[model samples]
Target chain A: MNQRAAILSLITPAYLWLALTILLPLSAMLYYSFLSDVPIGNREVSWTTENYRTFFEKAFYSELMLRSFKLGAEVTSICLLLGFPCALALAKSIRGRTKEALFLLIILPFWSNALVRIFSWTMVLRGNGILEYSINWLLPGTGPLDLMFTYPAILLGLVHSYLPYMILTCYISIDAIDNQLLEAARSLGAGKLTILFRLIVPLALPGIVAGSFLIFIPVIGSFMEPRLLGGRNGTFIGTIIEDQFTAVFNWPLGAALSFIMMGLVLLILFGFSPLVRRLK
Target chain B: MANVSVLNLSKNFGTTTALDRVSFQFEDGKFFALLGPSGSGKTTLLRMIAGFESPDQGSIHIGGKVVDHIPVEKRDIGMVFQNYALFPNMNVQANVGFGLRVRGISGSEMKRLVAEALELVRLSGFDNRQPDQLSGGQRQRVALARAIVTKPRVLLLDEPLSALDRTLRLEMEIELKRIQRDVGITTIFVTHDQEEALTMSDQIGILNEGQLVQHGSPVDIYENPQSVFVARFLGEANLLRGQADGKNVKLEIGGTVKTLSKPAYPQVICSIRPEKISIQKEQEVHRSNGNRVAGRVNEHIFNGTSLTYLVQCGNLVVKVFVQNLSGEVIPPNSSVHLFFRPEDTLVFPDA
Candidate 1:
């Protein structure tokens, strides 16, 4: 009984903090999602389901959501493809002080402000930017490659922002794998590709799944990078939601849209949960 | 099956030489053990043979072919690590059939071969069980099965039984020998456990400080160890420093020691195993053409089946092992006579 009391006392503060921060706001959002209008400054309001109906009935909202999900998938795939090899090199090829230094470099972007990082990408990606200048300098006769405010620019910023997550997760799992297993495979006549797919990839699947979830969920719900980097091509479900709250002052629509996106994300996660458990 | 031979194999990691100029022939279809303590380069030699680590100065020949530049997979050898190294992601059957599958052998042939290999290791009908589900001994068996399934030219085991418990280790020793004999593959096993090496291998090579100190059969290595390191490493040895003349040596402790073989140097150290020396109460009559010494019993240890008495002869405390057939215990401070045959005494240079 004393042990139980001690555990309860230790956890109660954290639980209360989470309730205040997450649960209370979520409850307010749910209530606001059902209202006809913003319940602020003594404005008259009524409980309604029109905000949710707007999301399902309109083709525009669903298309934007699909586009947002596509962007998330593309970013996740690119991150995984680029990050897994870096992680393997970091965890296996390099060793000692070099590995630690490389690891620090991989996570260095996280130390800087995300907004600053995104804006820095814009400066590098604009028409007369360092990338175009370098290409023109190398080729001696290249056109102005104005890559700013494009879909690729948003992808570049997001991948840079989230690549470390994939690499770190993969490095952790791959590093935990014993070198003896690889040697054993080689001794049993397994070639390089065989070792990678049969041994390393399967053993590192948990990290791949985890990294994918970490990158995908936030990218789909992201508004800042798409707005700053994508410009005219930046219209996504997240931007529409942002307009509903800050620009249009339609809190009910924003709340409903946030809940719908949460539901879809939860559904996607639920669909892949069985695969993750099997990997474990 | 192929005989593996290394010719003056040498390797150095930074300033420390991991393996010196070592050369040995591991006979085909025989179980050979590389026995040594830590930092003795036993594992490094094994890795060189397995093609995991290349030797810097020597060539490794498998089946009379110099395989110095061959990659590990192309070398066609199977190895079992100390940790077993079974793929945790694979089930028993998948793990066992990995080599065969990688070699493009599938369908009923793969199934039959995997089954036969598993049955050889005595882990049959465990097709779907994952590696984490098995015990340590069982995982080792699975690793063995996986290694031999592809019928590689040689099988290398790196201290595979050291991870098991005492009783399990003993059982696996016999089991491993049986499997090796049944498969009749050229096997090189590396281990630090002298007892395990002595019990299982057909040939034993003792190493110390990156050099091969001695290589012989188990009985021969035990009976004739050339240096003090091998004499003490393989088993306990009692050394007596003395001045030698031919097969006889005048001891500093006021007794004469004899050896069947003459010593080359005037100064010699005679080694005698504890069990070879017989102890009797000083009052008993003794008649034998052997070296005899009188000592006071310092202490005796009762080990259920045998008794070891620490006898103080002059300034030396000689250990003698006696069978506990009569259940007799010798009290401390009693006078005793220790007798050892001249043939049982081994002579080495004093250096």
Candidate 2:
């Protein structure tokens, strides 16, 4: 009993810190969602359900949420398709020092700040940037192309930022496969293509599911990619929430939108949990 | 039916040669075992025959056709891995039917054949269960069913019984021999267990250092080993290293020693199996015997059915086995006389 109490005492500090830092803030945000922001002469102090009501009544909020989901799905699917094959190649072909070097290359972009990584894509995709210059050079008479502040740029940055996560998870999974299983399949008269689909893919499915969740959730909540690259036609829910918090000073509405986003994240997790269990 | 001929095979990984120039032949429908320690290139040779490996320089002929360049799937060969590599996601039926399905046979015909193969290995009604749900012996039987379903021209087993328990390994060995005979498929098995090789193979090829040291029937290899390594490897033997003079060999033991048969060369080593040595009472020992040694038992081990004695003669300690009669027992630290017939001794060229 004394030992148990001592262990609990040692863990108490971290427990209190987590509750105060994480749980309390999230709880406060949930509470704030039910409150309404009113206009006073200089400041506002009112409590009502109008903020939640306004969000539910507006179709634009729902459209932004749907659009974010669509973009997140696209980014996740593209990352999986490209990342799985790249990871398989890396796991199978590279060895020793070369494998370490390739792994380092995959994770090198993560070392830089996220905003800088997003901005780097802008320099290349802008109207007068390297992509436009290349197109003009290749087509000769073609004028400069405009790709700045577009959906493609945002999608590109999302995939670029999250692909390493997918690849690393997939590499770890694929590397755990026993080489003898592949040989056994071949000996049973399975061709290389059959082995890939029937053996390798099924065995690596858990990694795919894990990578999907890692890339999808973050991409949906991302604000910088859409904010930097989305022009007049492009707007995501994350950017709208950012606008409400910083530019408009509408903390109650922002809190409502954040709660809605958290609900959507939970829904997405609910949808994916069955799939993860099935893969296992 | 297939006869496999490996001619002048050599494989090198980087600078280290895993297999030297090796050659052997397995007649059709014969159970051949390649017996060796690890790194003796037995598995490499088996892999080459199964078409998973291509030798740097060699010609392999199965059914009198050169198959050195053929891919594994095109060779019509079945292999059982040591780990019993069954597909984890598939049931036993699907795994057993995989080869048939690959060959474009499916539906009722595939089902019948898979059932028949599973029945042959005595694994019926296990088709619906996954591999992990089965016992080790059951899993091995499923692996065998999977391999034999396609009626392969040649069956290759790479240490298949190595993962099973001792009793299970013994039972599976008999099962494998029976199945191989019943199917009449030419089979080549690779194992490091000498007893398994001696018991199961119609012909045993003893390999050492990537070279085939001896290839013969189990009896010939065991009774007439051509090298000290073979005699020591196959079973227990007491080696007497001595100088060869004409047709007579001289031993450092306490008696006059003579060779049973003279080799063309001089300077030989002789090996005597422990079972061939007879222990006699002092009064029953004849003085005019061809070879006899005087020794005292240093240690005795009672092995249920037999007693093994470690006897010291002069400066050499020799092991001898005595069958236990109903009431016979030998205690340790007892005086004993060891005798052997001259022709039972094996003489090899000096290493």
Candidate 3:
């Protein structure tokens, strides 16, 4: 075969799979979103903008969507705050087998099934669970220490689930930076704080931005953790979307809500991309 | 600009010694080059001076203050890294002005000084250009400008020009020397390139195997290297193993070669630089004052400026370079005498 035919033959299978799996479902969802009702079992289904109009008209759906986005922003902030220093330590201070071991431990959560991991957090964070039990055992009459199904518990779970993504991206970026740059800064009479503010943060901005988006995008769409760990308080945009499909059986409304959520995520990502490019 | 000195400085990397009781003084406003082969601890010494590494047992003094416990930032030194570690996100102006800005000098004053430094390195209008936009040589200039903009007491360059091509290296070398002279900041440059050290430094300190083997002006070190390592490392040397007499070594190549220094040992190593040894068809009466070795030319290498003859004598091949002024290329297998003045021969212990 000639070059063009050979290239087409090699790429056709993957492209076909993507079209069948992702593109087809997305198109179906867009169509389903505009219908007045389900087209099934001889029910009269008519085209209408009612499903989308309900979204703009109702405060509940818009509130849940905003709440879901707020959760993403909070979790991503905590992850960056905690994980950046950990990554810097791994990249700059630790070395040899020790660094390898710590790095493996950080990403260990990613190797396991995410659902299993979410289930496991309930064992630790639930009322009278390991943390509460351990605390009461240490300090006799400190009470039940009820922390499960709270906002903080949900935040903690999300951060725990995604901290590794932040760390890995940051470690790669920090590791690529030449140690000489830091030394050069010091030799030029820059204190440690100045070096961090002036030299290190700007250089690692791209990594921080990438890691933030990776963690934020998934956390926004996540339903499993909110259901298993958060209980009633986890009823955010994601859980509401799940309700539209399974509980209410309103696939059209779910599709409209999903599209709106996707638009907000895209808007946020575009806002941060210019800053990333500028730093680079 | 102030004098810097280290006394009995030493550094060890676990099982291996990187620098051992090394000590030297760099005078104010003097350009010093620490010359050595790779892994000779030249860069290690330079880092210690820059306060990047603390010597296990030594005291460093800058100007007149002991700065043994001082951190690199507090020590007020400037370093140019081998790779020219300019801030990648920062433009040339920001990089140069970093030292001054961190010192709390801001606004137009900082801008003026940075501009002055850029002009000094001959990078006047490159202030807005990021480090990525510059070529290898231009980046090198930015690095130099950044280093000296703070009027650092001492400028430490760690093989800053090794990344450039030959022509660029030479150009940067001349440019660096001119900048160093103009600033009059005490400067110490570390390099494994001997020609660089020879041409740019007021004083050259040679290091070998974690030890300071010799330190002197370039002329003194080049003409009178005290050890086998220094003699060979500073420039090429044809070493002949021999037994020492009062002022000469009885060569292993079946001849007596004259020496400049009296050897304390019975056996010695005699080193003579290639260019110092002149090749002649036969020894003339006036040339009898110098030591002589007879050999057949194994091969002749010709360039427009110089000619090199690989002469085989006894069991060894010795290289000799002569200026191409005569415009006559010597043929291979021709018998010739290798002549050198007795004072040009260097004697060292046979270890």
Candidate 4:
């Protein structure tokens, strides 16, 4: 009985910490989502469904939600398409210290803050940035091109930011594939393309799916890239939520938008559950 | 069926020579076992034949056509790997039908051929079972069935039964021999197990240090091994280190022992099989042969049907196998006399 009591005492601190830090905040957010904004003095209290009702009633909010999902999906698809081949090359073609160096290069961007990376992209895509300058220099006849505050710039930033995640995940998966299976396929009259498609790709599906989700979830609520590179027309749901809290001083509405984002993430998680189970 | 000829085959990886100027001919419809220890270039030779590997400085001819430049898919050969190499996602039927499908065979003909191949391996109704669902022996049979389903002219097997248990290995060996006989395809089997090679191969080629030491029929290899490596590798043999002079040889053990038969070389190492040495009581002996040796029993090991006695004469220890007939037992530390006919001994050049 004394040992059991001691063991329980030992486990109580971590359990309490998790409850206070994670579970408590999530439950508070859930409760705050139901509260309505007070009319005056930028305050909100009491229970009402007006915040969710307003979001559902407004076409702008719905469009923002759709645009967020579209961007996330596009970023995930592009990352998967580009990252898988890069990872395969890294895992199979490179060797020794060269392979290690390539892996480090893929992961090097993740060490810096995402805001700084997005700011760098903004500097490059601006009207008189290096890209426009280089284009003007190379073409000579063409004038400076305006690339800032564009969808492509935001998409480019998002893809560049999350590509490392996809590549690393894919590398782990491709590296785990048995070389014997490829040799076996080759010996069994399978050509190089057949071996890659049938043996290498199918075995690396789990990694690809995992990397897709890792990049998609974060890109869905991305704020930095859209704010810096997208400018006025590049506003995302995360930026709107940030404006409600910091500029508008509507904590309840901000919490409500955050809850909606969490719900969207949950929907993605639910949609991917069956795929993950099937892969396993 | 086609004959495979490897001429001056040499493969070098960096500084290590995997196969050095190896050349051999596998006759049509002949079951040849490339018997050797590990790292003896047996599997390399098999892979070169399968076209999975390209020899550094040689040409491979199959059916009088140079196939060194041909890819593995165009080689038109079947291969069974050591691990069975069955695709985990595919069933036995799909695996067996893969070659046919690759060759554009479909419909009832493919199904019938796959069925026939499965039936040849005695696995008729196991079509839907995946490789993971089958036992080790079943998987091996599936590999064999897959290899033969295409009716390839040459079949390459790389230690097909090495992963199986002893009983399963024995059963598969018999099955393999029966299948080879039935199909009548030129087959090359690679294995490190000497007993397996001796039991199943019509011809065994012994390889050592990337070179073919000896190639002959099983009887020829077992009865008369040409080199010291072959004699030591095939089975247990008593190596009598001696200097040959005319019809008499001087042994390191005792005085010169006269040979009833002469060797081709003046100095040679005589190899005598353990079973060739016969032990008898000194009082029961009627006649003495020139090849007979006097020794005392140092140790005796009972091996179910026979008793193996280690006889020590001076510094030489020779093993002799005696059948345990009439419920006779040979005790260790006993005085015994061993004898062997001169014709039973084989002499090779001393290395």
Candidate 5:
């Protein structure tokens, strides 16, 4: 028919699916967050702000939220530090079939199940496990080096799960950079570190920021890795929210906590939007 | 500013030789051009001089100092890439000041130097504009400013003007020459365009198949080309293979062409430039110092300023250029006499 009709028809299906799947569920959660109790199973519920009030009134929820943010920051920073060099090597130094093979290996983790990967880490990290046996084999009778059920174990697992995102994004950015620019910088008397910090890193900042967003947002809300790798030490805001919905059946509190976490994330993203704009 | 010299520099990429024992001296305060076709190893030679590519068989000396072991960063050279290669993240000022900043020159000194460089390239008010925002010519100016801000010992340019449009390229040719003269840096650039090398360089070195075929001033190389390849490459040349005796070449087309210089070998090729041959409708005057050939005009290709007439003489077609004066053209199929001086007929030994 007309151009407007044509455009609407093209976009209608995808938007319709998103509205039904995401927008409707989110609206239901918002309504549940204001209720005093669950609105099902013959429980008399009234609309109230008590569930949200409990989150502010208690220090437990804020502390767990801060701890989750800390964990996200640590994992994201570690991923950037490790992944950027690997990406630089893959994009700049390595070539041809080797680079392609390395790239395949980087994303190979995604082919297997995430739960299986976390469980496999537990087998290597537990007391007197593969890691301990290898260490003691190197230095005999060095005692049981147990890292299981610790915060480090959870950090390690999350980093392992998310590092590929950082590398792939950074590779795209670094690869797009012209080699002539590097040579020009060197001819202008820029040494290795200067070229890296000034030319290469700044040019690749968009990728670094994108990778952080990809890893950080999901990491703060991650529940499985911590639960499997970290015993009691893995109790984050994610675990508390999981307990609220699945164990305690406090749907209202869980909805309120999820909304609060989302608000904080939006604030953080909004604060750094200028940096992203500058990259563009 | 210092003279740069490469002594027998050679480079091989796998099995193919990119540069083969190519050696030349680029005099200080002069503009030198490495002219060649694609894959002729001119770019490879420039890179060797710039310390980007190392030679397999020789050493490079800049200002009489052997810099084979010196790294590119410490070479103290300035290079402008073909695509400008300006840092997209920084503005013009930052890009120009990067070299100085890396050398630990900051504050007012760095700013003043960067400003002077931008002014030299006529990009004074463009300090805050990013590279992508600038036009092709403007980005080129920024690249030039960035290259020379630190007052490098030698300047290397890799086809710096090939990215610009034709009119812009012509303008930049003069602009680049003036900037080089003003800075007085020993500058060397690689180009495949013969006109660019002829118009811009103080000395031109022609490369063929990774070897230095001929090198001299523009006029020397154009007037007295030592080889057939050099004679054809610099400009349009009408090559006629024939038997030579003393100063006359008996053409295969049943004519004898006289030359001022005798052929070194019995068999030689006579090279005559298109512009050197004059066309006459009536053959009446013989100056006794020139060679003449009778031909019929086959075709006339006309431009605004000049006309190229493809004249067919027997079994050969000879090209002759005439100035487009009086708005007249010798019609095709007209019998004409092509006249050129004996000295204009360059004789080269055919191998």
Candidate 6:
């Protein structure tokens, strides 16, 4: 085959899969979002912009969307702050098979079922659970901690689920940094903190950014973790969208909300794309 | 200015010894080269002095104060790495100002000092260029500028010129010495290149097999290497084994060559530099300064300004370098006589 034919053959499968799974669904959603009702059986359907109008008119929906975005930002921030150090330690301090093993442990959570992992947190975090029991055992008479089924419970679960993405990104980036650069920094009279703040943080920003997006995209669309761990406080935009699709049968409203969330994600990516390209 | 000294330093990496009981002192305001082959512990010793590694058994003193206990950041030394590790994220100006900034010397004064350093390395206009944008030689200059901007007490260079091309290396060698002289900081350089060490350093320390074979002025070490390793490592040396008797030695190649040094042992080996040996046609008879051996020319290497003749004697091929001032070139397979002075021969007791 010619080069053009060869290149097309290589890319056709991926593009075909994406078009089937994404483009068709998105186009159908957009069309359904503009309709007044579902065209089931032989029922007459009418075109309307009421589904999008309902989103702007409802204060509850807007508040939920904002809350979901805020949650995403908070979890992403915590993951970055915590995972960056772990990655630095893994990439710089440890070496050989030990490094490999520790890295494997960090990414081990991905291999198992994510829902199972989220559910496991309840065993450790519930009132009179392992965490509370351990503290009470140490103190001899401490009361129940009442840890699970709260906002913090949801935050913890989200961070645990997504921490590896941050760490893996940062590890690949930090590991690529030359040891000579660090040695040169120290030789020039820069302290450990100075080397970290001035050299490492600035150099590893690309990883931090890429990891943030990876967590942010999934965390914003999440309903399973919040539903299982968040209890009453888990009523974010994702849950509301789930309610529209499964409980309310408001397919048009659900389609509109999904499109809006996707629009927000695209805006964010566009806003930061130049910075990422420059860093590269 | 500070004179750095290491006393009885040794380091081991598991089963392999990187540096073995090495002791040396760098005098104030001098350029010293730690010359060795790969895995000869030259880089290890440099790292120990730079505080990247501590010795397993010994103390390091900088300006009469023990610095082995001190950390690298507090050691007040500058290092130029082999790859010229300039920060790729920053421009030349920021890179040179990093030491000053970390030390809390900012503002216009920092700018002035950074500019002066860039000027010192002749990189004044390259302040805005990042490391990736600069050429290899330019990046090296930026690294040098960054190293010396803080006026560090001592400078350590780990094969600083090895990354450059031959012509660039020669150019940088002259530039390095000029900047070193201008700054006059106590500098210790490391390299496996013999000619670079000889050309760039005032003093040379030769290392081999994790041991300090010899250390002295470049001319002293070159003219008076004390071991077979040192003699062979420092440039090209022709080794001739013989039985020593008083001022004359019986060459293995069937002749008694006169020597300037007397040996007490019966078996001795003499090192003769190729440049010290002269080649002449065997038919032409003339008095030389010392010993002469008859041989046939095996090959002649024309090196533009000089010619190297590989002459075959009894069981040995002796190398002779004759200056190419003569218009006529000697042909191969011709009989020739090799003359070398007794004072030029360095004798070692063969063990």
Please identify model 6 stretches exceeding 4 Å from their true place: A1-6, B245-247
Give TM per candidate. 0.98, 0.95, 0.96, 0.92, 0.96, 0.96
Using TM-score, give the best candidate's number: 1
iRMSD in angstroms, per model: 0.5, 0.8, 0.7, 1.7, 0.6, 0.7
lDDT of 5 by residue, B65-109 (tens): 999989999999999999999998899999999999999999999
**Worst-scoring 10-residue span by lDDT in model 1 chain B:** B280-289
Model 4's CAPRI class? Answer: medium
Q: Answer with 1 or 4, whichever has the higher lDDT.
A: 1
Pairs with backbone N, CA or C atoms under 3 Å apart (clashes), candidate 6: none
Give the number of colliding residue pairs in candidate 1.
0
Q: What level of docking quality does candidate 1 show?
A: high
Candidate 2's TM-score reads 0.95
Q: Please list all clashing residue pairs in model 5, or write none if there are none.
A: none
DockQ metric for all predictions: 0.90, 0.78, 0.90, 0.54, 0.86, 0.86
lDDT of 5: 0.93
Query: How high is the CA lDDT of each candidate model?
Result: 0.93, 0.87, 0.90, 0.85, 0.93, 0.91
lDDT of 2 at B187: 94
Candidate 5 chain A weakest ten by summed lDDT:
A141-150
Better of 3 and 5 by TM-score: 5
lDDT (10s digit) by residue, model 4, range B230-296: 9889998998878887777777676566543576676778788999888876667766764777777
lDDT tens string, model 6, B1-351? Answer: 799999999999999999999999899999999999999999999999999998999999999999988999999999999999999889999999999998999999999999999999998888798888998899889999988888888999999998899999999999999999999999999999999999999999999978998999999998888888888999899999999877799889877788868866799998899999888887875866688888899998998998988999988999888888876678999998888899987788898
**Native interface contact recovery, model 3:** 0.96
Error of 1 at B136 (Å): 1.4
Ranking by DockQ: 1, 3, 5, 6, 2, 4
Stretches off by above 4 angstroms in model 4 are: A1-20, A37-44, B258-267
